[model samples]
Target: MNKKITIYSENPFYDKSLKTRHMKATIFKMVTLSSLLFSLGFLIFFLSDIVIKGLPAFQQTYIQVDVTYNEKTVKSTRKAVNKEYRRLVSRSWLRTIPQQVIDNPNLMNTKIKLWILADDQVDQYLKGHHHNLKPKYIQSVDNLVKNNATKLRFNIIFFTRGDSKIPEYAGIKSAVIGSILTLIVTMVVAFPIAVMTAIYLEEFAADNLWTQFIEININNLAAIPSILFGLLGLAVFINLFGLPRSSPLVGGLTLAIMTLPIIIISSRAALRSVPDNIRQAGYGLGLTKIQVVKDHVFPLAFPGVMTGSIIGLAQAMGETAPLIIIGMVAFIPDSPNSIMQAATVMPAQIFTWAGMPERAYVEKTAAGIMVLLTILISLNAMAIYLRKKFEVKW
Candidate 1:
């Protein structure tokens, strides 16, 4: 008796396994897409909020007032404008009346209708903010508006001036200048040293205890908190070396150290990406190792190094913790033309303004943030352009 048994290769349940796999993959894709869209939605919402809150700062309300430059007017500006509209005029504007009379002696005892800055309350009312303008002052504002005397005008002072206790006069000029100067010093100090370190470690450093220790320390330094670097600057640069406490020099040097590890790590990665065969080929052609690196390796690695340096600089630009620790919170009304002068960067300035009592500073803070963002975005674009233009794939 011969019995034949047939073994089927297919499982009746295999289609369920395939369907389950596909179901898992589909769920994973949906989850990833949902997360991405959620993050993008939040970012869009945040930017829109900032734009909404900050757009009003670029234009300021102006009011036409009758100015009488007399001895009493010079002595007391409160009595200078019409008593009904005094509450609607900026004190900063009133404070300058005496000076204006002094500057132009011909204007003494003169009454002239002139356009002037509105008070914060008046400005707030015009901008649809919560303001305590009285019923009469509100009527006055409305009358001025009807007469075309109170109107929104493009504010040049906000851009041209520097930090001021008066919100209307406060500007980001000093902060912008300080940021630029700090970045200049940071790039000058960090770039060359970082590149050299990367080159030596990648090509020349041997497998030794000292080299290994150095490598480990560099990595660890990158992980250290930025505030720690600030403390280091406060200790070494300010306390020890006696450098100017709030100068861009101290700030830049601290940022340099902070950015160095980033640059070195990125540069090493860029250098290592070059094929070992390229180095061997150079050696085979009787080129010294130094020449091989200097001639071929460095050119290929520079774009990445620049990209990293720019990114590091952008990070430094937005850093407030370090600058605050190093005494950069001073009220800097005048732009510093020299690096050694006392300075305050944009982040520190924004932080300073955010804590102010005035509502106008809220707009200024957001506007400053927008400016900082613009600069960072520009730097990133430059990095991308350089990377694409100079990067060698082979």
Candidate 2:
């Protein structure tokens, strides 16, 4: 009979070691959670500040005034409104009075009460912002407020018009349209070329020194400062090719060059995500390599490719440095009708407005930022939706 003794070998510090490990893990988790919370707090603060400052720009102050559209008023728009209200009314709005009468002859010789746009100073004072309004003009605005003659109406002109020297008359229409056109050109030029380059490099090209060099350059281009691309565009497109300096064509071409590396990298990743077995299956069916890639692999990768393209476009849409370098910062007051026309994008417009020395422009700048943020958020959401919608589980 053998007496079996159970040997219990436990270190005396085992419990202490376990407790120490647990304490370290708990501390790490707390640190990470604090960092996450801190980031969220800052985001909330920034969003709240932007919203609060921007909301007022959607409404514009209008004053009810009696306008006599006669010969004298047509000659001198200041005579359209009464003497006391002339200082309160917007000069830009008043300048349009003669044209309005010319377009509608019935308005001539009519004594009608109308709600008209107020001066930027009057608008600021009404919105409780800092204004350089004279004491008399401030008192006049207060009186109108008391009598319910001044009201903040939805600013339809802000959406319909273009940039103006007057803050109240300025709008983002030109910038918005320019952005759309520039993005269109960017997508049209970059998308097909990038996808083809990515397909060739990832699917067909042999892995050699030349291929490795190209791959390295593409990666390096992605990391290059965007402003350098602007310089390249200035040198190649504008200087060498003689493309219009501030045109959307030049801006788009420039942005396309900058966006190419991003789309290529992302498209390659998308193509690689397709399993090799899919290609093998296509080849088993006696399909050519091109047919295998075109018919079998591309469709599956299309969603991811689109997602990356959209994200890249969104990034390009918000970029100002490159466009500014190519002269897209020019003050384009009218929406561009063609790609060859000089244009300014939303970011450039925002930059311009942010520099203006007016209290009203502060709200306009914030509002422009809000609009830009909304568009960017929508684009990112679209990318997410596309990824989720077409994702293959396998």
Candidate 3:
């Protein structure tokens, strides 16, 4: 009993164990910091490259040409400009001459000098990119530049028009409209159902086997591949419901299905974050469960619900596989006026442009990617802003 007792803290092994644990934690922190730096570096490089490639697409080459509006020019648009410069101009622009004459009959025999869109080859040459133009066209472009007959103007047509075989006339207008309409449908269908389902599961439903089963299935659904939702849309909306193929209605329905699990899961988490004391106090105040949820719980939880819904919609916006499976990848040359018309979303349009063999479409593809990234970033920013603006401490 008089012998000195050695406590664990006095032992050398104890000190060694503590040292080892600290070393491991330090190593983990260093590794995590390195990974984060690497990810940020890659993102910066990617964004820089896209901006460089896409900047060229916003400015288009235009050549000043003499146009003689006559019967011959109306029939053969090749005669609209000088014979030498005809090869440098866009054929798509030439094709519209007949319609132009019909619209303004007074200009039938007038001669005017105006700037016209150049052919893609000429455009490429003017931009100093790799071009497929022959020596003659290159010389022509050079001469036009020297004579101040050619200049790079802001590419208004690229934003105003739709998909075209000629790169000079192609634009994302139709795709943008299609994306807007599809998202509208998706929000309209998904938001209400997802919010209600989440509220029921979190507040109203009994903790029974059926409820557990439903919860498990919904968790599983959030992990499922998005393309499977497209197949489901094809089977249900297209085959069973007889919905129009490639329409915004079908695309929206498919995306709504895919977005539902995300919103429901997020909403449930938001609802659960409210303290139980709040519900108890509501009950003590002689409020029914429904009144408590609607008046007190829901109001506090609405910000979180909206934030989740926007995030889910942003995810749906960038989805390509699901839309492709449901036939939303069609070549839509005109903006759809109704939800039932054939349409193509921005991602699908970018997909179509990226596959083209032409050199000009490369810039177009990059530009489209930039646009899509901007939109997604904006949506995510809004979500973040909303979450922070209405965050509740309790």
Model 2 compared with the native: what TM-score?
Answer: 0.94
Q: lDDT for model 3, on a 0 to 1 scale? A: 0.93
Please report the candidate that would top TM-score against the real structure.
2
TM-score for all models, in order of appearance: 0.91, 0.94, 0.92
Identify the superior model by TM-score, candidate 1 or candidate 2.
2
Off by over 4 Å in 3: 1-29
Residue-level lDDT of model 1, residues 1-394, one tens digit each, is: 1221122224454454666899999999999999999999999999989888888888898899898889998998898899878888888889998889879999998899988888877888899887778899899999888888987889888878889998787889988899889989999999899999999999999989999998999999999999999999999999999999899999999999999999999899889888888899999999999999999888877788888888888888888888899998899999999999999999999999999988888888888888888888898899889888987878
Worst ten in a row by lDDT for model 3: 1-10
Q: Where's the lowest-lDDT run of ten residues in candidate 1?
A: 1-10
After the best TM-score superposition of candidate 3, give how far the Cα of residue 345 lies from its true spot, in angstroms. 0.5
Candidate 2: misplaced stretches above 4 Å?
A: 1-11, 14-24
Tell me each candidate's RMSD, in Å, in order.
4.8, 4.6, 4.9
Predict model 2's lDDT versus the native: 0.92
Could you tell me the TM-score of candidate 1? 0.91
Residue pairs with backbone atoms closer than 3 Å in model 2 (clashes): none
| Selected candidate, larger TM-score, 1 vs 3 | 3
